[model samples]
Structure formats: structure tokens, C-alpha cells
Target: MATILKRASKGKAGYGKIQFCGEQARRDGLQYFWVDTCCIDKSNACYVYLPDVSQSSSVLADNSNESWESFRKSEWFRRGWTLQELIAPASVDFFSREEVLLGNKTSLEQDICETTGIPATALRGSALSDFSVAERMSWTECRETTYKEDKAYSLLGIFDVYMPLIYGEGKDRALRRLREEIDKASRGTSLFKREDFSVSFSLSDVSDVEHFVARKIELVKIHKALGVDGSRRVVVLHGLGGIGKTQLTVAYAKRHKDDYSGIFWLNIKDENSLKQSFVKVAKQISREHPLALRLSNVDTNENLDDVVDAVKEWLSLLNNKRWLMIYDNYDSPKLPGKTDPTVVNIREFLPELY
Candidate 1:
């Protein structure tokens, strides 16, 4: 360890990654040298006062049922320094302990997205404005720091901001301040907008909703389902044919129009209508969205199944703004077990909840 520091301190190397970084920097015509090691004083240590009492924080949430002892046992994840190094750069390339070249941030985006539940765009270094507050919190949920204050300090760069680092302020206070900054920066912004594209709302015209009576509970349920940080959700409302189920949904949408980027109302009178509606949505996204072609699961030109799948993939994206789809007047496909085996059901094309 002493020898490694000596070589690095004197702009010399022990013939490994340090040498490679210098060479790469020279190729890029950069005279400055920077390495995570020796760049920051790694030897600076802090002692934490672990309390016997359990503290409840809403920001941290209930990440696990495990005891704090078990949580602290995973030391690598509990380190404050690692997350800062992971996200503070414009682009990051990683290497194994054996010095094997893994990939840059963009190259391993799928793995990152799957691991962190962060959108692909954010991993590729898109602006922090592209993510929601909940999304930001989820990224650091599994991480920890030696100092109570540093758990919050590590996230400043992730959110692309700076704050006065008061080491004694405590992590919860630091995190709360960080959130305040985030809220201030993100203030007055609409949750759903099409800043880059010009696409019209595709749902059919509805009768006036000013007089429509609101069903508050169902509306709240839909909001919660959409806002939940995990899987995609589906809420099914079943009742007699003339029970105002469709009206209830329409009224709910009218009440909460701003909550979604788009609201699609599918009048499922028959299989043909469903297919036509799905295809229309696919074409709309393909024409209007920048990622439409990249996200294609199927070729729209060749087959109907592909187009529907493409639409599903587009909507499935976190980058895709929140959207609400109501399958009003939906009916079951099977007719009392007298089903034709060859006929394709329209319900099959609907996007399955994750």
C-alpha cells in the first residue's frame, strides 16, 4: 500500500491501471492526472455513534425487515464514498479487481437500469430534471455511509447540485435540505409534458364533465397505483352493464387530467376496434417519440402483433410520461367454453402489468 501511494504521488506507476489512465489522458491531450485513489484523502476516518434505538425516517423508507446489524454487515454498500464515485462523472468506465475492462456507463445501461430501477436516460447522463423525486430516492435507498451526514452528501452530485457540507448536521437534516433544493428547482413544473414532440391527444371527444359526479376513492386508488415506485399496476372495476362504471372512470380522468401525459379511452365494442386503437397508438408513438424506433419490439410494417408489442414497449418505458388507459366497455373473450381455438382475442394485445 505504501509503495502504491509512493508511485502515484510521484507521477510514477506500479505498471497497471494508473499507467493506462495516464496514457489515455495523453492521447486525449490532457496533462492533468486524476485517479480515485490519491485524488481524495482515503485515510480520513470518522467514528459513528450507533444508537441502541431504532430511528424511523420516511426518506429512507422501510427498505428491509432485517436488523441494523445485518444491514451494516454489507460494508461495501454501506460505504459513503462509492456512490459519489459511481455517479459524479459525465461518463464512467469500470474495471474489475483483476483489471478486466467492463464497460462505460452507457454500455452497461441495461444492467444498471435493471439493478437500480433508474431510467436508461439517467444512466446515460441525462439531466436530473428527467427523473422524479421518488426515482432519485430509490437510487440511493440501498446505500449507506460511515458518517450519518454523508448518506445525504453523496446524493448531491447525483441530483447535480451543491450544498454547504456541514459534517455535523446529521444525515436526515442534510437529506431534508437536499430535498428542499430539489423541490425548489423542480418547482412549478408539470408532471406530464411533451417538450420535444407535437402529438395530439388520441382519445375520442367526451361529453362535458363539469356536471359529472366524482367517485373519489377509485380516483385515489388509480393515483396510488400509478405513483407506486415498483411494478406497473392494473385496476379492474367490474359491475352490471349499466352501472355507470365507464362514467365513473371518465369522471375520474376529467378530475385528474393533469396527472398523466396522455389519457387513452378504448371503447372496446369489439375485437376490431381494439386492434385499430392499439395500432393507432403504436403509429402515434413511432411518429412522435425519439425512442420509438429504438424501443421497437416488433416491426409495424410486417405484422400486427409486432406493432402492438412496440406500443406496449413504448408505454412500458420510465422515460415515457405517465399515461392512463381505460378499457371502457370491455367484455370477456370466451363464450361459455365454446371458443374457437384459432381466433385471436383482442384482450391478448393489452399491455400486461409488470
Candidate 2:
């Protein structure tokens, strides 16, 4: 007679339980038994006992009513294979049974735990002991927090401040307003699109500038002179504000983005803004906030000495990799005090480039 192996419901038994059952069946004069856990493992043993269910039961029954409610709501218990069917050898096929059971267990746990405020262990017992309940709880909590955060800044709420203009618009105009609102909420960080490498420029109406052509040539020359040896080089394109300085920089960045491994463009219109922008850029590239590196206490006007130090440190590390740092509209007042004195003369930030 073929061996009869019993498997606990997907979430109620581990590999050891299934293996023990198969081994027991074989010892009882059965020729073959379809057991996922034992079949998947080469060496099989019968002495192993089912894992202790007391710990998980305590966690679940600590809040008995809640646990029962959660268990009832659980997709695993409510759906296809019953606990009896899982343990019945004649009910399921040997091949691929484990996969289907495990998938169902996982999906059910996630769905039930998310919908009902219940501890997962109580619903399925000690079967899925290896999975971390705390980690799943943390992830679910984070998602909930993010959703609630997004709700605080609703369209109606923002419209109250920018009112008449937002409501007086047509569908296309309303969409533009909505985009601006979303951009503001995201701190204007949505400037880059993944599909194409391009920078935002306000020189759309400038005809005589020929910004794109001029910057492309400059970028090629800069890349060639810098060579592929991976040395950091600074090319300062300084001119009057409206004379396409920003446009030229944006064009250069887009054209030569592929030449370098990483490219970052920053608009430093003021000293404080410059510091904040640098910190943001540093966080994006290095995964560490500049202020968090050394200073614990950070405020708006607390002197950006820490920020300048952080940027210098990051730049030194990246000296081995080719990078371009475009400082757009950097001629604002208070620039001298914000920049490093060792880098250039205090009279103007322009001398730093030289």
C-alpha cells in the first residue's frame, strides 16, 4: 500500500511536520507517500515531533476575540483548501502542492492582517514561524502613515489658499493647476523624468541665444579635455542672468549626461537656498543627509558651515569618478560668506572657478 502522508493546512505546518508524517507512513509499510516537505528533502526522519504551538497560541489568544475575528476574516481559512483537506493524503497531488499551499498562506496572511487589526500568529498557529510578524506590521504601518500624510494636503485644502484661480479654470487649466499643486507638495523634486534626460529651462522665448548648440560644443570640449581618466573638472559658464546662462547649463547637462556616470545640476539663487539644495542633492546621491553626518541640530539660519563641509567631503570621495556640478544663477548676495574661503577669493564666487 502507498504511504499516507498528512500535511497541516498551509499556514499550520512547517517542513519538519510533513517530513515526519511521510517517514511515519513509510515505517508503517506504505510504498509511496506524496508529501511536499519530505519529497523536497532527500533525508527523511520520523522521530521529529510537531513544533510547540503554545507560544504562538499565547500571542493569538492574548486577544482572543480579536484573534478569532481575524482568523475568520483571513483569506487562508475562508478560501479553497480546508485544514482537513491539507492533512488528507488522498485530497491533493504530490507535485506542486506545497507551492500552491505556501502562496495561499502568504496572500491570506497579508490580506487578513492588513484588513483586521490582529496578530498573524494567532490565526495560523506555529506553522509559519520563520516569517517575521513585526517586520510585516512595520511595513503596513509605514504604508498607512504615508497615505494619511498624503490626505493632509488635499485639493480642496490647497484650493482654499490659491482659491479663485484654481476654480476658475477649465479641465486643461485645472490639470495644470493640479500638477503645480502636486509638484509643490513633493518639494519640486519631480523635475526629472525617467524616460529622457533633460533639464527645465526658462529660456523658451530667447531666439538669439542658440543655447542648445553653444552648450553642446562646450560640453564636448570639456569632456575631451577632462579625458576618461576620472578627474573632477569645473567649467564655469558665467554671463548676465537673462543672457541664457541657465539655458546653456541645462543644455550642457542634458547633452553630456551619458558621458559621466553621474550628473547633478543645482540652482543656488541665495545662500540659505544653496545650502538646503546641496543637502538635498547629497542625500539623493550618497543616501546620507549632509546635516545628519555631523550636526545633530539643524535650523534655517544656523550658518551653513556644516553643509559646505559635507559637500567638500562628498566631492573629494567622487574625485575618482567623472562628475559635473553646474551651479546655476550662483551670483546672489551673501554668496561669499556661504562658500569656502580657501576655494576662492572673498570678493566674488567667480574666482573659485578659475
Candidate 3:
């Protein structure tokens, strides 16, 4: 672990840049160099040395359209391992045989997309979960590997799954195992699946709500509050007990049901009820989100707090915006003391609005 950390600190600096090139990388504040034949940590700066693309005087020109065409056809992009190599690194610098700096991933985003068929958002570092599984799989369609099983093995990181590598396994069996692991990982996290775009509404209180009329002003206010910007927003609907606070929120959600990715409601009258609401959200989203999958299995009968935290984390993802959560019956807010154990802290259950 210490060795890995030390290498990671200096930056992983090589894409088949070994020997003298590796020495040069070490001098440039990078201690570890990678090659096509070995694997290294993904969280490091990558320096790709394309031996086929010889150094040229016009390579770095701003109008070098032909240079990008040459880059697109480079042997580097056609390898199976290159798919992971391109996407995993936070930073990548391309170079020629004579070590002339060509450009970085940011500057070459358009060319990379054209060659690989990956979306610009993905290449620009959007969460992979935000893309569909089929779309991701298509990125590797043109890549080739030495062994048949290597094609399936190369995609382990893309799907975020792992299993023992069976070298002798045929391509069909390897792909089957890969699919099984993917299925296991995505058991109930369909909320983020690009293929499953149906809006998730788990508010049971509003099931019977219909023919909502009046509160046009209140509904408009709610819409304005949530639509102000791409940031967290909250609007507390304070009113008398029987003056229809709950009904107003229900009506707002139903009226704009198609506007959100998901809609969840929590009964915030007490701590126990709030926790129960979180459990419901967890079950509704998934027993465990991909981020929380390593923590522990979330069962309603056990580890209720894990479920609560996991659900909150799921909502906090950057790509997971457009999700609306309602805290109903928040009448008994807990005071700043142990004397009121029955009361709830509304903030504890609220997710990052954006």
C-alpha cells in the first residue's frame, strides 16, 4: 500500500513510455511509468507515447486538422486496453515518437469522441453511471485484444465489477460472467440506469390525491424555488394543522410529476417515522446504492442507519439532480437537547436538493 501511494503521489506517467522515457518521466516528478503490457493505478497523470506518430513540425499547430486525423488512426486507439486507458486517467498527455508533445485529453476531446463514439460529457468526466450500459459497451466495439476472454476482462472497470480472471475461458463464458456480475451490481439501482428513464415516485400519501385545485400561487412558488438554479433549495410550508399543508405539497408533486427524475416523501412527525421513511426510500431506490454497496447490506430489520446515509448519498450525486423530496408532518422539530427525543431534526433527513 505504501509503495502504491508513493507511486500515485508522483503521478503514473507512461503509456508504453519505458526505459529512457521512464527515466525522463521520473525526472518530471513522476516515479512510476506504465506500459501496454502492465496495469497501474487509475488515479494518476498519464503520458501516452505514440511511437507510430513521428515528431512533426506542424503537429502542434492550432489548425492541424490533419494531425487529428493521424491521431485518430493511431494504433493506440485500437487496442482493447486503450478503452480503459483513455477513460480512467484524470489527465492524459499525448506525445510522438521523438517525445514531441502533441496535446492533452481536454484539447483532443472532439477527436477522441469521433474515434471512440463516446459522448463528450463522458470524456469530460461525467459519472459513468449517468450513461446507459449499452452505450458504454459500444465504446469497445472497435477495440481488439490478443486473447478472446480479454475483451470481456477489459470492461471490468467500466461496469465497476470484479471477479477472478479465467484465462482459458472462452469469450462467451467470460462475457456471461461479466454480465452476471453487472446484474448483481445493478440489482435495484435502476433509478440511475439510462435505459430505465421512468420517473420514480414513492410518495404514498399522495396516492389518493386528485382534482387538486386552488393553491396556484403556492404551486407557482414551489416551482420557482426549485427552479431558481442548479443548487440545493428548500421551502418550508408552515401553516395551521388542518389548513391543507400536506395536501398542497401532494398537489404540487402530482401537478409537476413529469418534471422530476424522482419524487420521495418522508413522514417527519417523529424520529422513528423519519427513519422509516428513509428505509422506504432505500428500498424504493435500491437495497443499497452503488456507492454504499461496500458498506453493508441494508435490511429493514437491521442497519437502518446505513440505509438512511446511503439514500442521502445517492441523492447527493451531481448527476442525480432533478430529484424532489418532501418532508411531510414536520410539526415536532427537536430542540437542542436530549429532553426531546421524540421530536425530529428535519435537516438530518433532508438530501442535498441539487
Give the top-scoring candidate (TM-score): 3
When sorted by TM-score, best at the front, the candidate numbers are 3, 1, 2
Candidate 3, residue 166: the lDDT equals 96
In model 2, state the lDDT of residue 285: 41
Clashing pairs counted in every model: 0, 0, 0
Instruction: Residues 1-354, candidate 3: write the lDDT tens digits.
Output: 235445543444542355545655776787666555443245777778788787575656665676567778899898888777788777878888777777788988888889888898887778788876656776786788999889889888888889899999887678778868887888777523644323356566445446646469989988998873446777888988977888888888878887887788887777788888888777666522212342224567687777788788777866667777888888877667647767777777777554
Backbone clashes in model 1, listed as residue pairs:
none
Which scores better on TM-score, 1 or 3?
3
What's the lDDT for all of these models?
Answer: 0.56, 0.40, 0.72
Which model is ahead, 1 or 2, in terms of lDDT? Answer: 1
Worst 10 residues of 1 by lDDT: 44-53
Best lDDT goes to which candidate?
A: 3
lDDT of 3: 0.72
* TM-score (all chains, Cα) for each model: 0.39, 0.36, 0.49
lDDT of 1 by residue, 1-354 (tens): 334446555544444555555655566566566654323322221111122223345312454434233223334334556554545455555443333334455765655555545577765556665665545655665666778887777777666567899999876577677756755655576541223222346445444445667668877876776673335557878888876777778777766676666667665667666656676666665444422343233455567666667776666655454677777566655456657654446556666554
